[model samples]
Target chain A: MVESRRRSGRLASVPTSRNVKVSAGLVALFVVVVAAVAILVGGGDDGSDAPSERASSTTTTATSETSADAATLPPVVTDDPRLLGAPGSSGVTFTEFLDFECEGCRAAYPAVEELRKAYAGRVTFNIRYFPLPGHQNSRPAAIAVEAASQQGKLEEMYRRMFETQAEWGEKRESQAGTFRGFAEDLGLDMKRYDAAVADPATLRRVESDFAAGSALGVQGTPTFFVNERRIDPRSVDDLRNEIDAAIAGS
Target chain B: MTAAPAGTSSDAGVRRLGLVLLLAGILGLAASAELAIEKFRLLEDPLYVPPCTLGGAVDCGSVMTSDQASAFGFPNPFLGLAGFAGVLVAGLAVASGARPGRWFWLVVQAGMAFAVVFVHWLIFQGLYRVGALCPFCIAVWVATIPAFWYVTLHNLQDVAARPSRLGAVARIARENHGIVLTVWLLLVAALLVERFWAPWDSVFA
Candidate 1:
């Protein structure tokens, strides 16, 4: 019995007033620390980073350097899909690793489109497939786009993929059929399209881009590179500013 | 202090276990609150990034948006808020010389058992399904494991009168409980390392 154990001093004695105060103080300290952590680190994932929009407009130091380690940057591969401007068009080489199923990429589309219009001949825009594993239909969609590329509808199919991303992005299952429909609408030869989508080589093609992006520390989709420098800008303005700076510097 | 069970025995080991649980509960509660706050912020503003998400290796957003974040039809951190509060209170009581009865110990056992199981399930989801580790959730996992371990060991110590078959196990639970906890935690850490080997190794490299 517990009573006997208590009498025999086999149990911890009730703390004295001082010890009680210490325990209470410790609890209070823990409460304060917990509150502090909640208040300090409670922002969503992007909270950890400085607000790039504010940082860029206010301080020059924020956007000065980006992944300066050139070794980690992806090489300007010659055969990968090209957009806006061809490879080595003029001054700056603008490469983006984008995921069709990623919302960030969808949002960046308009800005990138505008950028293409603004700096048509001055910059070479290259888009690479970096279908994140988490996006349900991104990989299949990437393969579909690449397949369409073989049929000379690369630009049109690429735009269509972004335009129709909402139809398939984040779905629980693959929407390869919807993508196939897109290919059909684009007038890609159904046989070639079917063969490309079904082939290991097409998937491997996408995988190669992903591997290249992975090497360059591309953690998320919509990763932009201005002449092999990582650019995580907040707005189209920031992106344009960087491009303009790159153009001017070149 | 007033609720100390009559004729109760609170030994040094139980006191230490109580303190450990108390601290773990507070830590778990903090992580839970931070996660909950970040989740709500994300709902309000889709572009918001959680502070715990430092880089690709530690991203709460990817993990939070996953289906596993709401396994019980509600956010898991909501469960943590309620569960860790209970743990905090129970731990404080135990530390303050309250020797719990059988029913109380059973309740603690149930809570801790559920926590341990849920932690493992979340670990699986984080590694394989969600494909990202939320730093705050990982902190919660770390706190919950020790809370469960110490509580279960203390509960076993409390029972004292086990069946002949369980007697040896109880003795070991009491005598070598720290080792048991350490090994169990090491197993969890090993799983995490194995799951994120490339990214984890890259950090060191």
Candidate 2:
């Protein structure tokens, strides 16, 4: 068998004109096999969980334009421990689901803050957690944020987390230690911050936020619902337009 | 081992090149199929973000679920599979020693042109609409860039004809190193712009 295979291999290198076709065929077959293997193995596990972490990020965007009639949909129950935004108001309520470890979420932080400042009383903002599983520091980051909430420093923790997302995203020499440093920067009690992180209730709150996001059909982090209406903004202008429309609708 | 006539020798070369392109097409087909399956799985669970999900800035599930994922009602990746299949069949036929005429190659080149535009659309959607990146989808895009270029190169007998867009755009494809380099450079430029410049503009704006 080995000799026969070797003979065929030798034939491939021959100057015979027909070998061109044969060689191409063989190469084509090799490419097909390689591609098949790549698709099969490289496809791998999706690892979606509460937060989707699909490795393939380039995809066609689904249309997120919402009809003005979403107001008729069932009112959002803000009293749920998971609901971070205050509910029952008639004006535009912007609820954003975020993951602290997510870079996109961090990028949107300033934009969201700007929207908040611009809309102030016109738009009531609420934040929910949708920690992606791939982010090792995300759950801890959420816990730290909640701990800061306990100390009336939730907004500071939120801003600080976004500002320093890149630092923690890279392999921080020590995660817990690094988060503690954040706590110090935010002027929270170091011991209490540590305790809150370890606290099961705080963790539960974060987990509950994930559940709420899922229940609301929030598939990924940094998703926002303006006035309970799903709005997909392709640019800052697009987001501004959506907010403007929602505000005008009220 | 006698040498054939010049016409026959060149034809043989064409056949060999066709086979190489067929192999690329098959790989593209397989890649597209896998992407489609993964996208379907995400539809079912909604929360199942693949490893490609980096964060809020770049999420695989977010990009996949966007309207841009299915410009043709089906997952665009599957369209890639069909397109690649057409390319593979034509290439394999040519490699099998069938000429398949200029029309066949023309059609294949046209399909690839549409594919180039489609991929650009997806990139724009990711950068603008979703504001995230899907890593595997990007792999598909990378693989496609080569496949499209090679197919175009093969059809244009001389690689030098790429910048002209006359050969492949019409009936014959010119084959030369210049065309190959141009396509390669264009792909690289697109990726660089998307990676560096696009995001900065989006954020700052």
Instruction: Please state the error at residue B157 of candidate 1 in Å.
Output: 4.6
Q: Could you list the CA RMSD of all candidates, in the order they appear? A: 11.3, 15.5
Docking class of 2: incorrect
- Residue A155 C-alpha lDDT in model 1: 88
Lowest summed lDDT window (length 10), candidate 1 chain A: A52-61
lDDT of 2 by residue, A1-250 (tens): 2222243433222234333444455556655764575456443523222122322222211112233354443333355423333333546677777888765575566777777767666667778777766567878888888888888787788788888877786343447677788889877888888888888999998887776556565655577777666565544555678878877788
TM-score of each: 0.60, 0.48
Per-residue error at A31 for model 1, in Å? 32
Candidate 1, residues A110-195, lDDT tens digits: the string is 77888788878778888888877656688898899889888888888899998987677768976988999999998889999999
For B1-205, candidate 2 gives per-residue lDDT tens digits of 1111211125545555566567767777777877787787665443345555544344566666655778878788878777778877877887788876678777877887888777777766666554556666666666566556655555544433334545344222221222333445455445534343423233233
Q: What range of 10 consecutive residues in model 2 chain A has the weakest lDDT sum?
A: A54-63
Score residue B165 of candidate 1 by CA lDDT: 56
